[model samples]
Target: MKDDKKTDKPLKRQETEKTQQLAEHTADSTGELMNTNHGVRINDDQNSLKAGERGSSLLEDFILREKITHFDHERIPERVVHARGSGAHGVFKAYKSMSGVTRAHFLSDESLETPVFVRFSTVAGSRGSTDLARDVRGFAVKFYTQEGNFDLVGNNMPVFFIQDAIKFPDLVHAVKPEPDNEMPQAASAHDTFWDFISLMPESAHMIMWLMSDRAIPRSYRMMEGFGVHTFRFVNAEGVSNFVKFHWKPLLGVHSVAWDEAQNISGKDPDYHRRDLWDAIESGNFPEWELGVQIVPEEDEFKFDFDLLDSTKIIPEELVPVQRIGKLTLNRNPDNFFAETEQSAFHIGHVVPGIDFTNDPLLQGRLFSYTDTQLIRLGGPNFQEIPINRPIVPVHNNQRDGYMRQTINRGKSSYNPNSLGNGYPLQAKASEGGFTSYPERIDAKKIRARSRSFFDHFSQAQLFYNSQSDPERNHMIDAFSFELGKVQSVEVRQRMLGILSLVDKGLAAAVAFALRIPVPQDPELPVNHSIPADGNLADYDPFTVDTALKASAALSMANTVKDTIKTRKIAFLAADGVDEKSLTTVKAALEGAGAIVEIISPRLNFILSEGDEQIPVNHSLLTAASVFYDAVYVPGGTNSVATIEAEADAVHFLNEAFKHCKAIAADLGAAQVLEATYFSKKIPSEFSDQTVLREGIVVGEDPKKLADQLILAISQHRFWEREKPRKVPA
Candidate 1:
């Protein structure tokens, strides 16, 4: 069989042309003369046409009016949520045919490459907000398949904050900046958010995720994405099964420390965005394994949690994900607004095999996405936008809306008309036309939730129990920090009460930090969002003691830690640095797929021991330890002394140590290590085991040090060092 892998084959012209259509609207004026919007050459663009040099501009100056009018109306309405986002172009290919499970062409065809556009974003943040906000990330992917566009609109976390779509608005309103003051932008550490969360027990499971390390991702390329809701996959025979989507990054899931995340937000507000753009630009394409947890329709009720509940997750232990395909993002968008910003994703955009379940939240989004695009993208016809257009031809009776790019020529615009001879007729299911699963329903309409969704604290407890020691500590610290920011005593106390349901120790830790007594007997049957006519006793959440105490998959500590690809390593050096030690280590890291940057006392160039000018990528004044994944100090007689004397260099190493990042130095640079605040905490011997455990290496052999540093960086971070040997950088 011919190989269908994108890496093995050249990009097809059709795919290039699809993207090029948008490129035609783009222009670069590097060597071109200035011209008006109409392409007319301008003799005096700097000065508008006027009666005199300083006199009022003439009203007849079409150039001036056109320029100002275009500038004035350049902005579009940003997304109400997930306003800050970065997108990339890519292709998805199935590893093998999934025809037995689903009839979706993209999933069943192994030879086809489906064009895709993925947008990574942070929820609760506006277009101008910082990317490091501790919140859920929007991981929506638009797959332009032969059948149509299938949008797997998801979030980084597997669950949401609410069970039903009815509470979505209330959840967003509370998490957003207070309407009165509009304060605490892109943050959920305020009283309003906690007040709402404390009242709604259904949000407990999602809150655990929000407070965990997953909320603060190191980079968009290093995080995981989930479809959040349980969808349905129907085979050609009309057999249906429950399915959940997952995107597991090939780079492994990793995250920055909460403190480091805050520092990054201040240092570079566009940290995640820049990281993704730079990775693709440098040819380190980000890739993810598409996985699905398929649950037989009959077995869905076997789980303790409700499959329809958006706030629960079917643990990996219960249903292991089957890795069936790959999604590679190889190209960055050319224009941010034209492509990335204008892109629209809808949960309802499913093809033949892919169908929706009765998930309340998913049902609500089916209506919300199209309604939002109607106003946000300017009327209805948003799918016609180049970035959003499907690969297949779109032919329908509907036409002529705002921003109508297609000029249709037909005598009849409606169906059942002989004037056009039924030209744009619909296709049958056998002909690749979509057909919704004929799900039977026989029940009275009511405003209520299933009794199965009443047990909300079980998964929350499982999540807390599954975390590693260091992860648990981080969660405690996170809850403490967030609650400490809450000004309302009532909200803080109530949140502590809610936390107690998940874990008593976690609640006690936050209570101690807040200097408030934990409420011994807080409100039971807590669900303030229950319907007005509903029975409070029946609506109260029940804490189920799940058979599984913990699932290792819930913790990031168990994530892949075998490669350091795309990791940024900063080489600390100075004038008269040992050229051999610097060059050898730099080569080893670069060869390992790690990006190496030279940092010295000053930018431009630094003289090495051989008197060769080594270019510096960043200076001590401009670079921060938080910007790199690891730190290395090369050796030199004068270089060690100069770096030792530089307080910023000493603090750089110390800060890296504080954040549990790998730190390496040549034996000759002992003086430099000794100058740092963390030097005294280093172990006496540098054994192979100790080096890996401590994430600190000091040796004479350049090659050995470089190899050990590569292994240390692959571990991501030495989180074990955070609490035991905490230091003041």
Candidate 2:
């Protein structure tokens, strides 16, 4: 077994030729002349060949025709779901062999670094939707292993909104823009969505996740990912074990406040996308630990909830995750359209040792993915796309489809043809050929769900009870915000009843906000997707009380908050700034992997105490506090006066404080803080405990202020101040 504590290094491409092969398609047009699609050097690309100076373009102008035609066909059909996305190239290396659990080469070979491409996306958004939508985020990873490509198609949340795939269409349609007017794009806060959700009790657990801080992640690098279905791992001995995959980010889970998320959407709609690209380019590679919870087949039914139920999770307390591998995303895609957009992921894509279970959701996705790809990618040969191609050589009888790139020379394409002498013979099991697990199954053909999958409210309660006070409050506020947008009073009342099942306090809170009474007994057997012939008694969901009430793993407040790496901090200053104080704090922050940018009242440069010109990253007019993780104000007689006078500068501090972000100011710059709305709430004295509790650091000494600021920033936020004191930006 490889050493678990060994530091992971960047993957070297010298071990495989696949990375180099992709380079051939990568184009850099630096210092290059414009050319046509045929690579013909063009000297007059600015203007098309015209009859005289002002006439219609000639039909003979192949350049114009080719350019226009290519441009017209550039866009392919966006995905029905997860339409907006960002992708990156990376490598996955196992920490130790997992031969006992499975025979998968990538998991059993510690030395091999498998190439991978991962795409992060919003589930219900369009190609142009905001990244801050309060919706589920898809976290799909495609591993280009020598055995073949394995796609772990998953989401940021461990559970999903629906148990069966049949309800997927209805769920999406309800959350998407209303069909009549197409209003409320990329949001679930609408009448249709609440109406659908209020009737679907299976969505209770997932709705808690959506309304929690998990829905609006701070960045893609700081979120936990999970394969929402239970899969099977087959060993060399033909032994099978049920598995649930997880990706625990190294940076830990974090999120922005709902109000801050709204502001960020307006300030930078591509916030997460830009952050990912910037992090990779700046050498701050994002990483995650690939973990798995393995349960013996005999122990599957030991859980209160069914393993096959997509809306439930095998809590970590019951089955702890064994993190056996590290996945590092070190390279950004060369082209968004050619790589990120073209990449295809399906849960059915698996290597030897990895196989599917009888999960109804997983079984349906196997058919849905292939069918969706056929229409969206324009053919069955979409795997031939450069981004989706496997590293291993593919040999098959299938050939000739739309946009087919392979050229075959054979007399027979059939499997049992003597003319070709069975040249493309299939490999035996010993030769790494995939063999499905030989599990016996004897069941009558039926459309009804299993009785074991009926429990829905237990895990939902567990998730709610597990959250920290701040997280719980945020969830309560989120429910209020979403249900408030709902137009139907009946839908709101029904949802409040569902909330009552999870927690009465949560239900009453949302009811108070919505100005509606929480019904003593709203309704039962709220499932609307049941078969017409099905008896309501058989379909009634059970409320199994789990042995463990609260799982620490369910709370984001318990996540790692010891590092401030890659955090962006803004230094508010202007003309005649204190150079000593500004540079001292900047050096300390940058030394700790924190990015420090100078923001002044004007663009270009700011004048220091010695009349030295100091460059500024952005002016207060263009930059907002929403774009940064924290705010710092350096002392300067003229700088502090200018910032105090500037309304935008004062608003920046106020907004940052209102968002519960860390704020630090020099003693000299206290006047500037006093101008902000939250200044009166600032404590009279500053201490280490006060700095941590309040998330505000102020000191006369630059070094001391910097030290306190670092500590405060690591805490991520001081949400305690949000409810007690609200500021208007």
Candidate 3:
């Protein structure tokens, strides 16, 4: 494989010595509790100041008063967008030095480990919202490099909802619940969102993504991240190149079904967060390959659309992403409020060798992110916050804001002061000072977008066409459902106009459900033009290029398989179970990395024939089948009889069957499988061993069945087999 992680240089131990020292002195590096902000080291924090017999509070207790006062005001404002988020600590390592491409030190070396903090969030939800909402996910990374901190504040989706930054507020307002009711707090399945989406032609591409399974990801570990807009990289030689950043999950892109996501929200509200924490705690660190698509400065305008457009992507098929470095998130936040909450990421915090582009939305984000932090963090000195502070030494002259921590020893607080021999002066370009790529501009400022951005349908068409058969069907169903909820006939019809521009067939299908006739094709400025140097049709999904077929890379079906590393499996058993068989099966599954939980009639231990007692983790009433990935039933005649008499036990099996999950059973336990839908044998043996048809594996010899069950569990779901069950897509 090519060494693709060459975009930025890494931080060496010697170069980061000062930063490491500063970090060690700060409260962030150590978890020990010492003095309060007031420098008081008085111990006992368990109880508050009280009167005789703890009947009344005392007024003379300064410690208790200060503690309560600070605690009461601890929470800062959550982000207006991306309020609900989860963050992790990681290190970024470049595959090799990328000096050939850029002068960014972090990407230019292989020996350095750049410390990183990454926060993943949903765009539309508030701080307490559910994780599985149908919305864009923010994938922002803050790298504490040798020179300074660099923030890649971006989204999971490569393309955005709109072309310009000015319309962001409008887009946000429209997508939020209707002003009158505020009915749907964090869902896109509401009227206001559909209304805005229906009218905005530019939102067509993103709509397909939001409507698709990508919106409700299975877990943050399995989703891809994109910088969203093109950025410029300038070397010391003054040569410039346009780059788009990508973070490809090593687990492969995966998402949960809409039904599963909905139920997971109710059953486990912190599903995504728990998944991440559990994975890290179990030592299964999440990893992503850092990749970048580079375009030489001269080839910037050779594409069909403007490189500055935020609502577009240079498909991997066109200019393939060169995997460069790797990012591994191994640690969870020690303190959610101090680390995850106070960590501020801004696109403007670029160090030398990396620069910006004219992408308007990016330009606006550069300002908005840092500006919002000022108010949310309570001061211009927000950078002083431990989580937000860079590892690099900050020597700016500005000082004295709210929560300021540093005590300046020198008399001079200005750069050009004779009082202290003019210390902290600006460094020249040779001393690693940042210099923007010089692209001579001589054009009049205009509110209008370039004509190159006009044809929104081509890329949407390309994406839709690029999907696999099942993926395409899911997209179609999602569009139908979202549009089906639109209360306005006009809104539904207008959206059909935009859809028609992408594919007439797709428009007609959605229109059929909305009871609206597809409107005449939307007007276009350049007759669906492709750039002279570019070929949009070359990558069309409708051709023999199909042999390269469903870019196995694009399908969630092709993700990491046969590894039950973090999969949850419920072992449904009761008293008088076959101890040897049960122990053997449980050990085998657990040894394969599956988390096994015993589900019995009661939480007490269930004793076997030889007096071997198996402690149950959950009872039938407490744990539901939906909470697990697969099911197992150990042989026990009385246990089978007991389970049959219980409604919840039967219901658990029924629900798991309806969801098309795998169920492994032996001779005695096979009676339970025969009692459910799986009693009817599947007509044909599936070539794909992972298919979960009826999910009932029977017979005395269960090793084959266990092997089959493991494979089925890895499939995530028998989505194709779902049609007969009448489960909604």
Per-prediction count of colliding residue pairs? 0, 0, 14
lDDT of 1 by residue, 1-729 (tens): 111331233225436656776676677889999888788998987788889988888999998999999999889888999999999999888899898989987888677677789999999989999999999999999987767789999999999999889788998999999999999999999989999999999999999999999999999999999999999999999999999999999999999999899999999999999999999999999999999999988898898889999999989999999999999999999889988999999999998999999999999999999999999999999998889887666888888889898888978899888899887877777777678999999999987788988887999999999999999999999999999889999888888888888999999988998899889976765788777777998877658877999999999999999999999999999999999999999999999999999999989999999999999999999999999999999989988889999999999999999999999988888778778788678754443323535788877888988988988899999899999888997
In candidate 2, stretches whose alpha carbon ends up further than 4 angstroms from where it belongs are: 1-16, 29-60, 685-692
lDDT of 3 by residue, 563-609 (tens): 76667899888887877657777777777877888999999889886
Give the range of the ten consecutive residues with the poorest summed lDDT in model 2. Answer: 1-10
Residue 202 displacement (Å), model 2: 0.4
* Superposed Cα deviation of residue 24, candidate 1 (Å): 4.6
For residue 348, model 1's alpha carbon misses the true position, in angstroms, by 1.0
Report lDDT (CA) for all predictions: 0.89, 0.89, 0.76
The local lDDT score (0 to 100) that residue 449 gets in candidate 3 is: 55
Cα lDDT of candidate 2 equals 0.89
Best by TM-score: 1
lDDT of 3: 0.76
Compute each candidate's TM-score over C-alphas: 0.96, 0.96, 0.87
**Superior by TM-score: candidate 1 or candidate 2:** 1
